[model samples]
Target chain A: MDGYKGFLGLLVSSLLVGFLSVIFTLIWVLHYREGLGWDGTALEFNWHPVLMVTGFVFIQGIAIIVYRLPWTWKCSKLLMKSIHAGLHTVAAILVIIALVSVFDFHNALSIPNMYSLHSWVGLTVVILYILQLLLGIFIFLLPWAPLSLRAFVMPMHVYSGLLIFGTVIAAVLMGVTEKLFFALSGYSKFPPEGVFTNTLGLLIVVYGALIFWIVTRPQWQRPKEPNSVLLQPNGGAQEGAGGLTVNFSNVDTPDSKLNHEASAKKRNFTADEVGQRSTM
Target chain B: MDGYKGFLGLLVSSLLVGFLSVIFTLIWVLHYREGLGWDGTALEFNWHPVLMVTGFVFIQGIAIIVYRLPWTWKCSKLLMKSIHAGLHTVAAILVIIALVSVFDFHNALSIPNMYSLHSWVGLTVVILYILQLLLGIFIFLLPWAPLSLRAFVMPMHVYSGLLIFGTVIAAVLMGVTEKLFFALSGYSKFPPEGVFTNTLGLLIVVYGALIFWIVTRPQWQRPKEPNSVLLQPNGGAQEGAGGLTVNFSNVDTPDSKLNHEASAKKRNFTADEVGQRSTM
Candidate 1:
């Protein structure tokens, strides 16, 4: 077996590297280019990359992988869910600010908005991110949805979460490269700052690959507790109850224990859920 | 159960879209920019993106998901292994050509190589891709290695395969965006070409998401035949008979039946494989 300490050590180091890489990108932008602000100027556009990468890339990554950290297991699943949702909420707010900065700066300069591929893809991902977050809260946290609907949405939510994380990284990479190429068009990239910015971009890619590795590897997935509520409380209430959770065994994230208990008790499902579970 | 027809239909459609996206990218470059060539000019650099996207992104994606196609289930393992390895080999060749074109064009024009983030990440991916391909063939296809060694490396091989696929897409996205921004400098993105290229990129992202969803989802993984040769031929010969295919459950791709029979008979290992399977 792999050493527990080794896994934890890697996790800590990667987390530090991931966070620091985001910070380093921001620092490079502030140090070499323009300092971050929302003063409705070209300098305001600098906050666009820094804040977006910080929130959409680094902070969101932490939120997604929070369950995998050992210290999180000590908390109740409800607390962890709150923490997950809370972190994502902060990320969402930061991204909104980032978007506003970009749009405002563009508008102030009479520049066209939503024109570049980076802008197009970046805007689409931000929309998807907001939708994913909203749907996550609606289905997972709020009591507006029933239990079986939550089960059906959970896998898609997880997939979208990871997909969005990846797309955000792509946007970051694309956006940064766009800025560099546009700004440094006269030169052939022999400048030291060009190399420095390229290094920053590489760090972003490394951070992204690291996050994907930590989150997606099967062995590194959060292990199921064997007696999670789905198996126990729903056994008598629903037919073929375990089918809905076959994918859960793979993801095995400890979400919300309160929701799990409340949702597990209502195991009855309509034809739609049956169809969903069949495809599960 | 999910309809076999429905799953097959989605797979076929997505594959077509994925393939066409690669073609669309190629056509866009050929039509709008310089047509494909290797005369050590700026036009030669055009071939880099088209060839890389078609081969590394599209064809490599096909290779990764080939086993998931139900028609491959009847093949006796070894044929599929050959097909998988052969496809990857072709992809490696294409990527090499793409890289050479870039480097060659850069050299002729007195431009620097590996200066951009896309080139840095792209070159690293190519190196890793070649290494992954070699290691895979060595542990999996070549007769030099024992089955226990293959089993030990299976999980990492699978993870690396998926990781490389994701990275290739990231590199493609980065490379494409860099080209667009650099080329479109001094002009705002208010043109038909920009729209067309953006659509091309969005297609790549969609195609990638579909491939990942198909290959990584649990229910959609290629199912292993329960009575594959690893269990039968090595029953009496090896101490731990199933040591050869412990992680075969994960990568249930059909490979060479001959190797399965021949190598399955000898499961010799010096204790490392013993510890490996415990985690497996």
Candidate 2:
């Protein structure tokens, strides 16, 4: 079950990321040609940031989806444990790639000293993503962890995805319009052919809606049963509704009849033999 | 209660709209001054579209909030209904104002024939916004309508807001950077107040986030109890330990003794009851 879910997560993430990357690349190329007059030198320099960030976001998405899947069902502990480690490793690598790209751009482009603030702020997002990734992995490994831990991790993944996606989109837009990296290179004045970025944004909106729906669904369908193990010690009653059984003789004594009547009222049961049935 | 809520809603809407109008007016004055030096005209025509749209959005927002207030709670149905009708009248007036502004701009602005498509698109948005204002007023009159109806109204509001906001932001950026409008007038160069337009884009992003949060938070919390009328049919029997009582008594015979036995074995009774029973 774990393996199947993990693979499914990987497949979905890959498809989304791959499609987004192709769109981003095409936009960058088009923008390069129109804005820069098809200058080859300008094109080479402008492509780095777009390529690097797209790659980082793609990998980071895979890591997040993998970490989130186990919550769908119970799975083998070993499988859960290994996937948890694997997600973290991928996340860390993506973060490192993001960091290296930012630093390399800073050195290569000689971006204005004042614009360093943008770079620093962008780096902060990478750091936050890495921290969220680590925490998610840790929570996944803890078998007895509360559901809230998983809940908390999901939002971090969402917010980080937004930050990363927003940053890259902004960078690409700036690159297209301003020729920020290569003054000689230019791209299309028009928007890219594929509306993937807009679609991706829509997808995020849908994902958020789904999360809200799942979290708030009514709980009345599942009622909590009593803890009978403490009373029986040997866990003896195991075959009735949700492993519970009636023991009528225990409540038949005259002294207990009033108490039993109150219980019967609460359960909406009229006094009858069938209610006395017990499981093994 | 309805009157109070309506009053509060009106107050909030008025304040927000008034404040946004002032902000838009101030931006217009500033941009007007910048555009005047080039055109030798007292009023700069370029700022008109942006100022009009901003003012329109603020007005629509006011109409939406006023229409949604729980006014039936506080007054006689006749009075509440009258107030609802009055609010719609005010919203319609604002829509008329928006329509006139769009038509005025359409007549004034001249572009290359190739750019006629852009102008048509711009006019389409204005028409859509006017339609939305009408639809919003309609929806406000019928608050008890299906969720799907409310859902349908929202996209018109959102998409129109986005289109107008996007156009104004893009125009402002182009005007500031290329001095596009200034070139047509006589201005040499303009300062980078395009950053302020970006700041306005950020405000739209913040506004979108807040709206998304408001719409989705209830879904994230437990679905609200299907309104009072829906609940009134059921006898107010508290379900189990919670208020959600689902009666399944018809599924099987009511067996009092057996029910008591079941409840006793399951420890369904309160702690105080157990103590009282022990004494008995």
Candidate 3:
């Protein structure tokens, strides 16, 4: 919102790229990994990667970038929070289904689970992801935590969200590779399935890189509102953060003995004037 | 340098993670991919993953983080640039060798080159990487380009370096998976070699995530010098990026009809004073 030049273009491109990756992953899962069928056998394993990519990677990217969209800047903060948390909620459910499919498939085949590094890292990331969502809601969305604690955890929430996103993408890469190796380990001189799977993996990587780059570009951060300054820890809000910030902390209702003649231009003042202002 | 509280810990941890990944990768290549003896055959292909990870992934990571190390900040900027570029040069050579081995093995076996998505993406990343290095040197280290152009491209150069680094990591993941799938397609459900290769892949992913996270953290950026602000695209340097900026654009070199008593703290100026400044 703070003038991320071409933000719309970038967001659309990110969504398109993410969609392409999901499609490629689905193709690999359905056509190559296992045919699309719910016979309650190994065919159920096909749901794992497809759902993981769809819910975890593609939808997850959307949830992260939702705030950066310029159109959402003026919407109420709570509304945006609901939309954000809602998307993540759905994504988490899909991830659950994805995980269940893998587990059920493993049990059906009498194969072991969590034995591969992919399983170890994948489960770790998903758990961390769930914790992140819960904590994000507690700190930023819900009013239970004090503003000070929310301020303190906000930076980490942002950082860890990105970190987990990257980790999940990496886990997906490893999972596909493991599957490929497991499925077609003895093909002579690179088979056709190898090309398809490698391409799908490549798309996932590209999709991830694009979304990370778009999300992290410093200039793209949503501009903070003047009232939002109160959200900053210690009240030392960013003044240079584009847009003329007006501090209304000292202003009070006229009935509260407020000076009616105070100059509007001199908005910023020390904390001495705090209680003069009326509560919202 | 401006108080990334646990920077030292993060840096140390990053290096350790990267080291572990490289060692594991080397183990996989040596023990499983191909034996030590080249024998003028497929054994040469062993060098591909080992050399790629060593040069492109591991050493390249070190090269990227060199700028982030606060201990080196006060050293001559030119020295840092040389070290950064020099490390990248070595990495590029190793990657060339890695590529050569793959091509040699492919040709020896009458297998095609650039046939898979891995080849396409891998080759593209390398080409972009080579161009990025050359462009970085020409625009930054050398004084050939005008300062305006240099400033304009500086942000992009930084961004693209990280992007290509990520793309290459993705390519490596795909390559290893394809190789695993190709080489071990018929193993009995999760073989030992698959475990080794999969674990190595996981390490690489973790290492990439750590390094990327470390490099991108804004607060962790190496603090700029007083004169560094002059490096801005419009030749207008930032005052104290935190606060307390001063403007002294009008101050002449002392005795040249200059006001000798100009306030030292008043060095930060507004936009009106921009064009009066000289360029490199």
Candidate 4:
């Protein structure tokens, strides 16, 4: 399969920026704010940013890009799906803890919870992330699921995953903005703390944009494995009615469903479409 | 010629939420804060949100999706491109004024400017937006340009347009959060103003998500015109090297270049490839 030019360079930049965001958040909380702890105090509140950057932004980004990694290309589809789901599960767990830390800090200080736009959007992302993970496991990882249903659900799955990732990035930015206003008194004066945190926010945005660019590129998408056993309705010979199970799930977004439409009819590729395929 | 199912419904919802976002920003500035002005008061700062919502979020979103509208399908591709660039031009002008308002407000108040993360991201978006606009005009809207160059630049043009739109929405949300914390007293108590502003933020997010969804759907993409004059290298038969200008820009993100590759080679579509085309 033809791979994207500069794929490695972009992927490396994405990870480099992603790790920088996590490290910056860690330093912001540890050195500028207070060190993290489990107590129901501001120290515990520090855990929120740390966990969020680690889980939601960094780990979740990795999960989204894992399928596109060239090293993973040779792995079984089922194995790749496990790594994807497992990373997401870890991210969800950390995000859940991060939420609890915020709520606990609010309760301890008698500050209200879920009052800010950041909270509203953050909660929505968390809920959607969880639902996406659950549905993904049930439909994609489960052995007994029908191929047609997977094909039907694949595009929505990819789209929603990207949406959730984007929403999370937006919410994190909102939270960063809100925090600077509340915590930094001389923030408007461009204090060192303010400048450093602003850089962190920029890094996060750049990292996210890079991830989106990498994921949405037609060339970088995970290629369809027509011979994968899991793509069959029941592993071996129990193909779906009308041989719909023969339509392999492309796993690429925006056009996956379209390809599904083509393959569901069991059509063979022509030279023109082969050129189109290379474009993808 | 098949159009997307429920395209109209989604388009309507996108506009509705987008307009609601603008309306909510208006109310927040007018009723909650002081009325708009140009005297470099906080009232003058009010134009920041108003112009941002009207131009960047609402109109900019419409510009991004204008091609996807069904009624506009009858319009020539050149005309549609004009409307697209024209709308973006309007958006850029308003955004410039909005930037002036903020800088003037800050200078008048003896407060520093471009200190906050919001400002950093907002300024980056504005700069990139202007660059995208200029390049778009030169590459896409102008006559006598080579069709090959247009095809080469179209994907980056669309990708950057969407990226700028998303970044603008994120910056706006960050600004909204910063404003709430700065202006509203006891905001954590969830005052009526805070709640209203929160709803506005959610509306903006929903509107952005809807626009992204509508724009990215393969079925809703602008159909390629195989015989359009504008697609010719120099119009009336001065075709480019290797007859490359025969490749029509699909005007669709993520896959347009793929279709271009398919067409540039001048291969006929077989039945299998035609099915794949429907997927696109």
Candidate 5:
């Protein structure tokens, strides 16, 4: 488990660095285009956004693994595990498709054909996010779950769904913007400008900040220990039990042997004798 | 407490509605301008972006209030109370300023320059938001606070920060894009194009989605109750004669009083006698 966790952590961090590199590359490309007095059409085909989004997906996967570690428990633990498993499964399948398309594993699959794969993967991520959102709603409604857990889980569900939503928006935006910008420049066959692409980048950053807030807020109430005996009736004596038994009727006297003998005799005595003894 | 909570809720909801309504109005105005064939000079003012941003600020304020209400603890409660007091004071001042500016109350005092009060109140609202953010940060760091509280607070911080950030970005973008587009169109000033306006609208929506995601994601570990007794030692006891006594000793039998008395006597008795007494 530790080894797997470490691997996932490393994978996420590496992907993050890669994503940052892609962003820097995009900035550099933009600056380079401006310096060269070239229009948007003269720029090379850019895969930076794609790579950055892929990195984000990997990071999401890492989040799932981290939340599923053994020490997590109760509602949180359960919710995390469920989300982790569900999301990872879907993410993995999407990643595989993305990998195949990127590598052109099929000789018949042209660049144009890959676009469909990308779109499909993007849509799948969005759908998975929606499912997770429903799961969040369901978790909150569970009768036995703690209220505090529900409160905490609701925000997480919202945040993750938003991340996936943002990613899809960004992907669509990029596709549209690139096509529109190319078309408007009259140097390419794509559309002049896309409403979706123009807005995608700004949305991602905004959503990222929102998600960060949801994950960091403090909670007031939390689940107590599961054992009811700890809060037992009879002044909490059940909590301090250590496998010992005492009979009060047999040990009423300070003199232990005499008290025991007396108790033994009393147990055997007739009702009349017991009544007389009690009167005495 | 319930009344205060309800009032805060109503205030937040109203603010949110007002904020969104302003945006809707701006969108309506933009569409109206386009329909009226308003030319270059009219669009240069770009009042819509400013109004939309102002609306967003109110939305952020309400979101902060909503997030803070649930897990509010000692210092946070006091801080929130003070914030409320400050808001009331600010509201009163704003009202007085509005009355002076609108009804010419300042003329009675032979002062013609009280209109600056409007800007001052606007600035106060911004300042209040900053203070609320700082208080949120402090609340997030409190011990014994719920993990969800931290999760919720941090995202709110980020969302609020981003709304501020996005507003600045939008303002800058509006300025730059207007100038660039004007240069491209071979006019010193031209009415904002459908493309530019639409692009800006898209940016706002994208950012809105991002904020939604940030507030909803499940990355933060929910706060757990302390497992050790030392951390919450007094949790088990109810009120007692001397406040409360946590009985940690192991005399839990039904005849605990008798056993305790006998044990005290045994301490004075010889060791051999004590042993014999126990066996008996």
Candidate 6:
């Protein structure tokens, strides 16, 4: 458990900063800007920041690290994966609403949409996110994929998930810069509102950095599934006939000794648990 | 070399897009804005983007992956480490120059400094980059640290390196947004300048993403040093007396099976080559 030494501390810090970021965003929009509203006004645009921080950045951060929560290791991986996907699903819906708010606000003010760098990167993050969500469900949630295929896609899925998260933070930082300049006339002079929002932006970045730090630590990863159903090399064709195909790519590195041991002891694992076999 | 497949293609793509981003930044500054210069002019501000993209983003990207270059695998690791550190040093110098240019321009126009979100984040990246460089040299480059200490710092070093890179991209994206809005008269209307700059911003994101993707792939990492000098566990206190203490953090993950193999065979490996031993 040497690896897990700082895990809890980092996890707590991540949660602290993550929620604090959301709270700050809410404070920025509600206190500094007009309070949130649904009407096609500038207030509607405020929803974009609030929703994005809550659902897109903060919730997405939680989803990325949820599997690493040692307390949750007792739960079935299928349940964990479901929760992961569910969080993502919620985030996607919030993002969509946020986007709708932006477009509505733009139309209300006759401001052109998709014209700034923030919009360009923000839109890309959105598209990539939804694609990642759908792909995660299809390959990981469904039991139809072959074990090998699932294994192969797992690395890319994990990498893209983290990358997308990083991009989300980047896009939000850009969005913040845009909003500050557009909303605050004395931004250059660092008025109270400007300083508060600037601090908020810094908090967002710190939140992201903390999440990235916590998730990438090798020692903090979930232990390998105790009872995975590994497929036989000769039984390739029957992989997806009705059995589980868990993605091992995320749970263990390609060079893990535990991975080799699992492969050697493949026959011992139950077919039903194959979908849960990950790092040890 | 199943892992090495597509590595070259990806490396080439990273380099191509990385340079293309710099070129586009240059075009945006020189072709769209005034040409670069010194002597406290707005044109001097152009160096801020140009130098940052070239050195901070592009060269830093190259530095991060230099160890992963298979062709360099044949070279002595000490040489490779030096080259890696050397590239980072070059990048640090360029970033410093970029900062100077921005400050000079701001001072000339009597503009206050470090007020904007971009400046806050950019300065943080700068400070962190310098700290990382210095720490890497102290713990990695110098032949003084104990193996255990080196191992402990390696994960953090790698994680911070990537996080800083991501932050750099985020900071740059914000810089792009700020510059476009300030410089372009009709950014909202999608003028030619606005379109080109926005594309430039997107290209920068693509470059950073490619670098992230390439560096994170397990297959693409450099092979372990053929003859590393390992240390005895009991001989830890004498580690930095005169021999090397190469960092394995960046080269191999903690979960690597080969690491266990190496540990079991620790007595057989020459201590001189321990600094070089990485992944197979």
RMSD for each model, in Å, please? 7.1, 15.9, 8.2, 8.1, 25.1, 7.9
Better lDDT candidate (2, 4): 4
Residue B265's C-alpha lDDT in candidate 3?
Answer: 15
Order the numbered candidates by TM-score, best leading: 6, 4, 1, 3, 2, 5
Distance (Å) between predicted and true CA of A166, model 3?
2.4
Give a tens-digit lDDT track for model 3, residues B25-116: 77887776666445547678888888899999999998887867878767766677788889999999999988988888888888778766
Q: Model 5 over residues B1-280: C-alpha lDDT tens digits?
A: 2234544555555555445644543663466443212132334233433332443333443343332243442233335435533443443343333333323422343433312212222334346455644554354323333332332243234445444433332332332232233223422233344344434434444444444332221111011112211111112121111000111111111222434434544333221100011110
TM-score of each: 0.83, 0.45, 0.77, 0.84, 0.25, 0.85
Off by over 4 Å in 1: A185-187, A218-280, B185-189, B228-280
Between candidates 2 and 5, name the one with more favorable TM-score.
2
lDDT per residue as tens, model 2, A22-62? 46555645553432221234344434444433444444344
RMSD of 5: 25.1
Candidate 2 vs candidate 3: the DockQ winner is 3
Worst lDDT run of 10 residues, candidate 3 chain B, spans B242-251
Clashes of each: 5, 18, 13, 1, 37, 17
Q: Where is model 6 more than 4 Å wrong at Cα?
A: A1-5, A229-280, B3-5, B229-280
Q: Candidate 2 on B1-280: residue-level lDDT in tens?
A: 2134434544554555445544744574466344322231323444443444344444434333332234333443234334534543564465455445434543455322212212233344456555654564455334343322332233234334333433332222222222222232322122244334334433433333332222211111111111201111112111111111111000111123434433333333221110101100
- Model 4 ranges with Cα > 4 A deviation: A1-5, A226-280, B1-5, B228-280
Model 6: per-residue Cα lDDT over A13-124, one tens digit each: 8899889989988888888889899899989999999999999999999888787787887887677888899999999999999999999999988889999999988999
TM-score of chain B of 2: 0.43
Question: How much is B111 displaced in model 5, in angstroms?
Answer: 46
On a 0 to 1 DockQ scale, where is model 3? 0.17
lDDT (tens digit, per residue) of candidate 4 on B1-280: 2334578789889989999998999999999999888999999999999999999999999998887776776777678778988999999999999999999999998888888899999999999999999988876666644445554465466667777888998999999999999989988888999999999999999999898777655445555444322222111111011000011123322233445644663333221111112112
